[model samples]
Target: MEQLARLEDLPTRYVADLTQKNLVPLWPSLRNVLPPLKPIPHTQAISWKFKDIKPLLIEAGELTPIEKAERRVLVLANPGHGLENMRATSVIYLGMQLLLPKEWAPAHRHTPNAVRLIVEGEKAYTTVEGEKCPMSHGDLILTPSGLWHEHGHDGDEPVIWLDVLDLPLVYYMEASYVEGGECQPVTNTGTKSRYGKGLVPTQHHIRAKNNYPMLRYPWAEAKQLLNDLAEAQSQGPIQVAYVNPETGEDCQKIIGYSAVMVRANETIQMSPCSAAQVFHVIEGQLELQIGTDTFNLEKADTACAPCFAQVDLINKSSEPCFIFIADEAPIQKKLDLYSVRERN
Candidate 1:
């Protein structure tokens, strides 16, 4: 009876304080800001099929002009999250950008970090700040924040690639900025082709521009690197993380990027990770198991796994399978909130 009476009188005590400065007690709002249970992510395992996306890309290529539309992209919006903003998952945004032959995507720069994984049709090049980075199937291109970049295709067929960006973080920080300009003239003249290799300037230039030095990581180089590493190991998938040539840091400050190649009929088990990840299959077929759900993926297909989700990769084909993977571990690590647990 005493406790009930005190609890009932609490509102009366709060009334005077509320009236003075309009201050409310923190106890009622504690559950929202400091809940006992961690948040349950609404994101679920989802995959995007290439068969359904290709035709739409073709239609868009025919109906839209690259210069006029700026970017002909189809966003892969997750049904479970971000209905209004149309995010791929909770923190990442995935889109398929298309460019027809002889078309050029105007030069532009933005604050959000953008990564591209080539899907189909090549002979296209993404030029960043006067350096041209060629694009091909299975290649991964990194365009760091505030870097002027442009895309153009000179091939006979249309070019398409997956555009992955950290828009959620940009929105959260309210640091979004975009501007367009004419393509910059190429100046670097070395043996690196200005498209496949990074040009080394002075240390002053390096520190002045803190963007990722390696603008383009060709598929041929990655495949050869994986093959060479696989020959030495002879077991398990050969994986490598993309790093900036200057500081040897990750390609993106907030995103950790890696590519893996699984030999035929091989299965690799991954431990539970604290960072949410999404994988895009570049070649062969993949059976991706996240927790209890298993998703079958093929070339150009993308699969997602939330944070703390255990994953398994199985190559269900006769040849090797390649996958481009991205995670938020970089951001989580910055907050000292990253952890991983091995799963049996």
Candidate 2:
């Protein structure tokens, strides 16, 4: 019997044959279609999560305006960088968040501990729980898991900060809740200067030794400290460490809470480490490569590199740039830092 048909008839018959045989040819419909992107396999039990936002811009195209207006966000988890979605537990979230001079994202709250490393800003504050915490350039603030916070700008220019949260983990736990502020620019219950100020000596558990009654990290002091430290390490890699204001200890926002220092054109080959690393570039530019993808992160950019991703850094600017980074740090301390030549 002749079952021959024209080309248009071939596809339907092929699908029918596949269905009958419990198999799928897929080639015809998939010839010009894309295969789903696969998440890379981890060697050990641990995994890594890092991204290249530039190539992602090229691949995904510009972010739509509605997206920008809703959350005031300009990027998404792109396939080019292996970010599955906000609900992907093993993934990390990173982006360049631009907040205008008068932009005030009304108060909202959620679970999953988060941190912010200010990229550039002077007169901004994120009132957490109920207290307003003043923000300065390069300051790091913590909004512990499940806390309500709001952002307001009273400064003269646009204020921007990096926002990081444990996305999928929060979703997986079924503990993520987001509620808008009571009203536009809802005022806090108490000001950071009034309640959390260093002047007050009421709460011991929440207060670090350096915990001033003030709810702010001053930039004037931070900038000077970096300048002095860089001058000392001028011939080599520079480091301006951030100790807890209250305890003068490392890893206060959990573990590996500190800012980093990098000079122009300097390249750092991060040693094999176990911490889930996060970075916000406060100044200068950097070239970050994970596997085959590369990222050129500039001021105001942020990244969260999970523990397993082998990492490398290349400085492309002319002056020193400070980088704000937080991570679990090398669990064993043996592979926390390394040289690029060694990685190569």
Candidate 3:
């Protein structure tokens, strides 16, 4: 009976031990340590080339069927986090998608603005408002908020591209929309060869591009100018990146965002302004300093600087970095000054 009592006491001890295990405290919040940054030089930074994507597409072809259907995106930012078969992880939901031959992604549309940077393939087109933009290598197509678009590739090879847009922000607002073209064919039926609709039925050149009116930015020409600038600098430690013309920079007519690039290892101090700005990096890395917070940036990452903060950026890598900065440009006038921030 004494032994049995001792064994029964052991059971109570075990219960007490289990109760003690539940007292673990919650972990502290993890904070991101920001680094010092400066304004990037635009000219030299634009010259930095994004990595070629053809190899990744080719590698996808070599994978097994299961892996082939899987996503093979190599993030321009967060190179470590490869989202295979899962939605991409970016400030925006964008990806460098590679589609195998005969793979047709159905038509869809949403409220958030979207754009596709065509990397390869021909004969496939994305129809927008009765006009089709050929998804050729190096071409950029727009799918503005609420616009319905679909992809149709009839060629013999895979088509790939870098898709960028503000998806997460829209989702956060609980304003997501989706529509398909399965029942209704694209507005462009058989007249697929009419890529040169020229004006897209617009009235004036200013109204054509919509952001100060320019047709076909002609990447070849832009690349040429950047290349020449790089030669002048001898591929120096920094490049002076300029704000994109379409970004509505100092343009009085447009109501959209604007941005420019800064060379890697370069520095820039932003002029103060009341308009808030968001910077998205497409290539290379950067460290930005806004007010007292320092953000170490990687490609495909974005940082927002409130209207009150005096902002500046620096390229931390030896290589060139490309960044797209967006803010509500002043439509009334061009602001040239040292301070763009105003205290409330």
What's the CA RMSD for each of the models?
4.8, 10.6, 13.0
lDDT of 3: 0.50
User: Clashing residue pairs in candidate 1, if any?
Assistant: none
TM-score of each: 0.85, 0.60, 0.46
User: In candidate 1, which residue ranges exceed 4 Å CA deviation?
Assistant: 1-38, 189-210
lDDT string, candidate 2, 1-344, tens digits: 23334435567877788789998555444523433432232221212222343333223323433224534543334343344453211433444455555666666676655666675658777777666767777776666655567677787765555655565455666877776655334354333333321233446656534332233454455566767887776665555555544544442333445556677777776764545566666777777766555777777565555445667668877877777765654222534432222243
Quote the positional error of residue 335 for candidate 1 in Å.
1.6
The residue-by-residue lDDT of candidate 1 on 1-344, one tens digit each, is 11123324576757677869977666555555554534456567788899889999899888877656899999987777856676766678889999888988889999999988899986888888777777888878888888888888889998899999998779878888899888779754111532243334554553436455567787877778888998899886689888776666677888888889989989998878777888999888999999899988988999888877778999878999988998888888989978887675
Q: For each candidate, how many residue pairs have backbone atoms clashing (under 3 Å)? A: 0, 13, 23
For residues 241-282, could you state the per-residue lDDT of candidate 3 as single tens digits?
Answer: 222343433322212333345665677777666444556565
Candidate with better lDDT, 1 vs 3: 1
Each model's lDDT? 0.80, 0.55, 0.50
The best candidate in terms of lDDT: 1
Of candidate 2, the 10-residue stretch with the lowest lDDT total is 41-50
Candidate 2 Cα errors over 4 Å, as ranges? 1-70, 75-84, 87-91, 95-103, 120-122, 155-158, 179-215, 234-236, 240-243, 248-255, 291-294, 303-308, 328-344
Question: Worst ten-residue run, lDDT, model 1?
Answer: 189-198
